[model samples]
Target: SQTIHQWPATLVQPVGSPLSLECTVEGTSNPNLYWYRQAAGRGLQLLFYSVGIGQISSEVPQNLSASRPQDRQFILSSKKLLLSDSGFYLCAWSGSGNTIYFGEGSWLTVV
Candidate 1:
């Protein structure tokens, strides 16, 4: 019964504005959490991941950062937004298995 939730489901922000996307996992403890971005017609890119509280790994150098303030809570943020930052953001969680569950996803449009 584990689930991942992310929000706001859709966003439209101006360039140079700050951004914050939050994700949380339920019905599981110490699950691996991840943030992924998929540009239009592109494959999913691993952004950040967390194995435990206060532990975060960045898969690529980007304009965003992630934080694991709690065991099941992960936050993705950027001090300023970029036009290239527009994309679909997904929050995922995985238990001790290879199976991963994804959220409904968030659509970000930087104008």
Candidate 2:
């Protein structure tokens, strides 16, 4: 019975503004957390994942970073956003090899 929550629903930032997106999961502890981005019909690309606290694996090097401070809380951040960063930001949760469920996401548009 795990569910994920991601917020702001939508975000608009300038080319150099900072960014923060939060995701949390209830009903599960130490669940694998994932951050993904989909741009204009493209597939989901993994940004980062954490199997446990202070353990984050990043799949791409960009204007983004992820952290896991709690067993079920995850965050995605950027010191300075970019126009190319505009996309659908998704947070996913899975326990072990189970299928992942995604949140509604925060649509980011950098001007």
Candidate 3:
């Protein structure tokens, strides 16, 4: 059984602070990992994705960046936070099919 883990479950940060959100996939090898963000009531937006370690693709340009330092570990980071960066961030993975599973998600509030 493959599963994705993301944390922290919630975060409160001031504007201009740094941010780091971690996600990892268990029980799978070389799976496609993705970082998606959903605003208060908006649809999920693809921020970044990785097909392999050290290989990342950005879907949109923003204040955040993603890295896959290890095979199954994906990280999202921001050097400086912004009020517009507040949202529900979800980590997801897909393996061998169209089905993608998501984590419990992290709620970020920038004050």
TM-score of every candidate: 0.97, 0.95, 0.97
In the range 1-111, model 1's lDDT, one tens digit per residue, is 787899999999999999999999899999999999999788999999898999999999999999999999999999999999999999999999978899999999999
Candidate 3 global TM-score: 0.97
RMSD of 3: 0.7
The local distance difference test score of model 1 is 0.94
Whole-structure CA lDDT of model 3:
0.96
What is the C-alpha lDDT profile of model 3 across 5-75, one tens digit per residue? 99999999999999999999999999999999999778999999999999999999999999999999999
**In model 2, how large is the Cα lDDT of residue 30?**
79
Q: Which stretches of candidate 2 lie over 4 Å from their true place?
A: none
On a 0 to 100 scale, what is the lDDT of residue 71 in model 1?
96
- The best candidate by lDDT is 3
Residue-by-residue lDDT tens digits, candidate 2, 1-111: 777899989999999999999999999887999999999878889999988999999998898999998999999999999899999999999987788989999999999
| Lowest lDDT block of 10, candidate 2 | 95-104
Descending-lDDT candidate ranking: 3, 1, 2
Candidate 1: the clashing residue pairs are none
